[model samples]
Target: MSLKREVLYQKWRPKLFSDVMGQDHITVTLKNSLLRNRYAHAYLFTGPRGVGKTSTARILAKALNLEIDEHGEPKIDSKISEEIDKGKFLDLIEIDAASNRRIDDIRSLLDNVQFMPSSGKYKVYIIDEVHMLTNEAFNALLKTLEEPPPQVIMILATTEYQKLPETIVSRCQRFDFRNVSNSEVVKRLKVIAEHEKIQCKEEILWFIAENSSGSLRDACNLLEQLSIAFDEITISKARELFGIIDENISLKIYKMIIENNISELIETLQDLRLRGIDFKSLSNSLIDVLRLGIFTVNGATEIQGYSSDFIKNTSLVFSGSDSRKLITILEKFIEMISIRTEHFDPLLDSAIIHLTYMFENKRIIKEELNQTQEKEIKSPLNIDTQNQNKNIETSENNIKESKINDTQSHEKGLEVNQISKPKLDSNEKQDWEKVLFDLRRAKFGKMVLGALLRNVEIPKKLDEKLVLKFKSKSLHDHFKVEWQLELAREAVKKAVTKVYGNGIKLVLEEPDEEQKNNTKANLLESDIVKSALAMGAKVEEEKEG
Candidate 1:
């Protein structure tokens, strides 16, 4: 006998309103609407991916048009349900705006929507990624979507609700499909684990649930991926597969940052990069652990996955304010991870413990601001008009004076990022390391160009130009590449001006004329090239004639 095989996600996909997880409020409302026989003409199901926007639409569609049994309950027609689930129902139309986002597509859809249902009571139209539609397409869709025939029901689904026009959103009953909560995800995963007979640790299930970031679809997908690797999944197997950092390592990093141990923090981050852990994942895990620490410190027990000893130890690492600050910084770091794929050195350069005391600075500034506002509020009427005018004038003068001072400093080559067309002073020179670090620390390139620079070591300075000799020709050739060369030059100049108080020229070795012509000579030996040459081929020269 052949064993049945199916994807875990597809096999356990919800077929009924009650079967949907982490969306009781939505499902309950949907069930109530069906129970009352109150049908909405259109619905805008908006939320993050995998929380069942499309799935719920199918369930709602089935409920709306399902054949009824004697008891008045919607009869379970497996074939029809399967068709709807597969988006193949004759009356159920599924349009992906990502592919068919043109006005013509919307017009075609509008033309077809006028017709009545062939099989059931209602014809359901599901438009996925509706936000991707062009403005003209949206205009064409507006009339149809707003006032479709009573028998026709439209379900518009989108991950980005904000991308949808307010005009469209206003016309339909909007239902937000929130990301599945971690607990709900965990509960569902546990059920699947038991069904699959995969005896995994509770922590493994929680880890999978947590990592999915509230997308139940993502959770299901992750569960399926794990299933491929393990008959009985363990936490270690999951961690290694996911490249999750150890608890001890996480604690150490957090502790080091909180303690303002910049060097240690940088070293730790470098080691993490060496191990090839995804920075995005590592950052997320750090945020989770810190959040857990906060809850632990506050004596909140609702969230699980942290032992008392672990929590207690973590709780001691940071105060309430410190924890909040660290969380904010980590959140920012998490966001930055999406912009670029960071290598080892760039990761350190991008992140450091230098700003660990930011909380104190912010707190002090807040206190000063509050005090000033309080004073102004208390004694506002007491001041004479003349004094008030004088005070205003003084404040304005102070602002002007500060601006002038900044301009002067920039002129004197004191400010690094001065954009005032400032000139470099002859007295100053570039601190190559610090300037390079500063340039790399900010957003520079898509890849870690700064990391590559760090590998090149200190550059040799020749009066007007700085000559950087890479250990190998490949590294040298990277700078010579058309796109990288200019950006590299700009970065080098910026660093030179910042450290040495002026931009310096970048000098690189050029390939010899013989070497450039060698490629053409080599290509002539090939049979194809020989035939092309004999036929008077217009073989392109390396440089312009």
Candidate 2:
């Protein structure tokens, strides 16, 4: 029988401080401390997983006990050093706090910490995922950390440093590790590929690096899987194995959107569906491409992975203003994806179709606004309470102007028909109340529209436009849907006709961070939230949409 081979991540683990990649700050500091013989008794290593926290702890252990050169490099050929490398050193203890997270376990370790090293000069203990320890275990360990034995060195590693007790964190010397950058990850992978004699395309390394999200261990594992699956690793094999959508497909999708080729776009989407392409991954890839495009348009140079021709085409397609709009669109899409639990196919299709005609829609809306501004009709029943006489016509034009002539609306069967209006005074507040009341009292689909606009900021009579400022994004996003927005626009115009008259555009403003926080505070103080709080329900803060 053949001997089992060591995994690349394990085999390629760094043995010296200089061997650690993308953590020069921590490595250099640790090396300095080792050279000066001033290393701390208790150390805390915290960062995202697979970023060499454990490996660094092991290296620190070897450095503290083993013989080192003038540059603080441990002599790995020594018997004790070899034992540490193979995880068989008696003085170096490795504990998985996730599995052994009890007061008894901690007490047992503390008992061992008081004893002198069997062979080495100092006893080294590495506790990984230390945040998983219970409160009792943490309390038990705190005293030892506060006054540790002179010969004992404890290294605690955790991915979630926030969960660690402040007392424990304050007692230890902390070192934070950061995610390895893609370029650095690529270089490291290339080094491993050359050493391992793996014949793989360079793109395959980038593919692995991109997917690993800066975790070198993840990148190495992915590359190892691909290397094992094929004699010579290829991009197609890696992508197919991982179910990753090809960048070329994403590039084609972008081109289709830029060209507004709905027919071809739909055809391509259908083909992707037939080929079992993951829409979620495709969305992410498009977002990456859009980000690169934005950077390339904004004077960034030497961008990798994308060809020069692709960069030139991207720059030609997007201006500074278009780049901002693209960011907004991407944000909205990401928000939609996070909030909704539905499948990605429909959302992907909707986003692509919307982006395809977004330019045309903006152009049409601008032209309509200009025409409305140029041609104004006199109002038949003008009640000017502000003493500012303005030529404002009926809001019939505003209602139709807000509707986008697109297939999405037609498919949804949405239409804005004229509704009988009740005459109102020129007071904007009264007009808002009356409009909201009409929406609530009307025998329509649900009272959703009224509930959505209950807390909206009402414009003043002096205001030329009827701006609808929502308190929260949930309400704003719901109201900003094409069909819902048109419906609300139609109703608000009809109700506020006496105040603003014609050429009054209905605007929806996205709330700022301050507004969102203020609104959230207000909601928390409401009776409903109070009741939930009384029922032992805690409100955790969520990410901004």
Q: Write the per-residue lDDT of candidate 1 for residues 1-545, one digit (tens) a residue.
A: 66966688888888877678989889878777777777689999998888999888888888888764433335566677777767678988888999999999989888887788888888889999999999999888888888888889999999898988899999999998888888888898888878877677777778888678788878888778888887877777887877766676777776776656667878878777787766666666666667776666666655575666777777776544444455667677667566654373466345655555543333444465687688779887464899856654553332211111112222222111101111222122124545544555433433344544543435544344444444333334443442233444455556566654553444343334454344344433457743443333333442322
Best by TM-score: 2
lDDT of each: 0.66, 0.73
Report the error of model 2 at residue 319, Å: 6.0
TM-score of each predicted structure versus truth: 0.60, 0.65
As a TM-score, model 1 comes out at: 0.60
> Which sections of candidate 1 miss by over 4 Å?
1-5, 67-73, 77-79, 258-264, 299-302, 319-350, 355-545
Error of 2 at 221 (Å): 1.3
Give one digit per residue, the lDDT tens place, for model 2 in 1-545.
86967899999999988888889999989988988988898999999878899999888888888878888878777888788888999999999999999999999999888788999999998999999999999999998998999999999999999999999999999999999888888899999999999998787787788899889999999988888889977777888888988776887887777666789999999999999887888888888877877787678765776657767766665643356567777787677666555666887788788887755543444465566556555334455755422223443333332322222332343233232232333244545655654455332232345544665666433234455655555445445552344454455455556345655544455566665546444554457744543333334442433
Span of 10 residues, lowest total lDDT, candidate 1: 413-422
Clashes of 2: 1
- Spell out the clash pairs found in candidate 2: 393-502
